[model samples]
Target: MAFSADELRVLRRALALALHPAPLPADEVRECLQLAGSVDEAIREAGRLRAFLLADLARYRTALPGSATGYLELLQDALAAGYRPQPDDLASLRSLRHLPLAAALLARCQGIAERSVRARLARSTAGPSGAAVPAAPAPRTRLTALPGGRADIKPARPAVPGKPAPADDPAKDRPVPTPAEAFPPRKRPVPPGERREAS
Candidate 1:
């Protein structure tokens, strides 16, 4: 349905009231829902409808301006108090806080490596003279050339137990026989009446 500019304004007002601490009377909420279509629709479309209201919030606020930012600040305070409004955020905040704790725990465990009571962290991982302990570089995989000039090595895939290969290839990708000598002929057969002696 096409909502007019006037209808949009009324819907915006109704959404704001739904979010308001001292909302409009029950009759007003129901009236807006009827205009909006239904309760399910109003709830489902709350975010969009709320955004529309927020976009034009200044216009409505100017009509009755009373420090609305105060409520937003209250929401921030609620976050600090650990009264999480969303269940999904509980794990996130806990993980965020845990990272610092992990760093501190690592710092505490530094003493276990050093026998000194002072529990000093090593400036260098090597000797007491502050010499550099070279980090062991990762090993490199040398690429050796195959029989062919190409570098890519196509290894045979590991075979499954039940299914076996159909044909035997003495040499992979090398033809069964070269073009010059693919077939060899056999001696011709003779009839019983026509013997070798008669020939």
Candidate 2:
């Protein structure tokens, strides 16, 4: 069924929810499927199929970028060739059949277009007043733990040249073992006292 722009948006949002597996309220579900009605079973089936497709798509993008690209190309071709969707077709389409088969296809395209427009607007506005806007930082993917099972962080700074750093903490600003406080002297047994000498 050819969906209007608004129907496309709702269907896309519902598909995104399903792909992500977020908790769907009863009212939300009712609202989502309201346009489908009881007769258009193809639309509902396509919606379910689209859910699985997008879920796999999300994973494929990260796991196999090249394969994901190939998948999209294949999906486009399949859609062009009358990709009639049969939802819950577990064997053939475990999580992917065609992208444009669902009513949300236009919405998917709109989302991408909207994102691009927003990105361009952000860049254009990034001059004097846009300083208040905070852009998402790029991902920094690296191993959390370093070699030898230690934290992956900067190395401890070496003591500056010529000035030996205190092995103990310098914060205390006092030596632990002062030379004045010496250990007890060895005990020596005195011979017969001077009284014996006077005798």
Candidate 3:
């Protein structure tokens, strides 16, 4: 919010008096109150303006290609005013992506949406105290031999550092057998004697 030179001087004096904890004369007290009122009014006005801009953006978005140009301009203004792009806004932009400005804005809006999702996920994953919780370590993996000597790798849950692993866990006893190992390979009869005689 922009303040006049007179208002700025009053604000400065009020800040100084606040820090120093001094009593102000009747006139200075009145001026400080007036300045505070002005600040509150300015804040309210900004909120109203932002609301109006968003409403306008929604109206334009609903009107689609007919209001494409006006809608794009309003969306740009809304973005500049710190408005988050909605799914409808993304869809609208995607439909209008043939326009150069619309294409650029679509990319920008997609990035904003992705960042918003990531921020939301981060917030959700945060601890009660608002600190970020560390991600769990990746599962451990090991290679196990198959029937034909081919190997396959499978994930195993890492044992807790201080806790003992379960005794009944089959994975702990041995690598889990594959289907090929569960059933033996079939054998085929051979005519080796007759082939050797012909040779």
Candidate 4:
């Protein structure tokens, strides 16, 4: 996407004309159109180059340790071309990491993979329009018949900054047993001989 000095000058003039809505000379209009065509061609060529690099990378990856040197080189080039490292690329690099170059590439690929995953997770969690989705509100508690024989819905307690709300705390809903309820007294049993004498 590097433009020559001549192309940059044409682009600048074109931009100025676009902003000011001024009529251009016949030659200038022709030059602007030619520049636009050149830019489009460059974009198309870049896409084709990226596709070719990816295909080559995949082939090199499939060849594994045997193509470690070539694969590493191709991978570096592909990365420069804005190619995202695939799982196959990561695995290939991992297997060939005995080589110093492979080890470095593996670290680089791993970082790219982690960032890609985080980006995907962030996108998935976002709303359709890419805005963050708001959390669902907590459910309200329903109270049984009151003194007036009417059931009521209780509002959920507001969450505290440092502490969990009552509904979120499992221990809050459970009733604690008293000592007597926890451990009931056991009756003493009489001896068999004593029971027979009493009978």
Q: Rank the candidates by lDDT, best first.
A: 3, 4, 2, 1
After superposing candidate 4 on the true structure, give the runs of residues whose Cα lies further than 4 Å from its correct spot: 136-199
Native-referenced Cα lDDT, model 2 = 0.57
Please report, in order, the local distance difference test score of every candidate based on alpha carbons.
Answer: 0.50, 0.57, 0.90, 0.86
Q: Give candidate 1 misplaced runs (Cα > 4 Å).
A: 38-199
lDDT winner: 3
- Model 1 Cα lDDT, one tens digit per residue, 83-112: 323322222223333355423423433333
Off by more than 4 A, model 2? 2-40, 66-69, 74-199
Cα distance off (Å), candidate 1, residue 87: 41
Output the worst ten-in-a-row residue range by lDDT, candidate 2.
84-93
Clashes of each: 0, 0, 0, 0
User: Against the hidden true structure, what lDDT does model 4 obtain?
Assistant: 0.86
TM of each candidate vs. truth: 0.17, 0.22, 0.66, 0.66
Per-residue lDDT for 25-67 in model 3, tens only? Answer: 9999999999999999999999999999999999999999999
User: Which window of 10 residues has the lowest lDDT sum in candidate 3?
Assistant: 148-157
What does candidate 2's lDDT look like per residue over 77-123, in tens digits? 43454443223222223334354343244344445456667887987
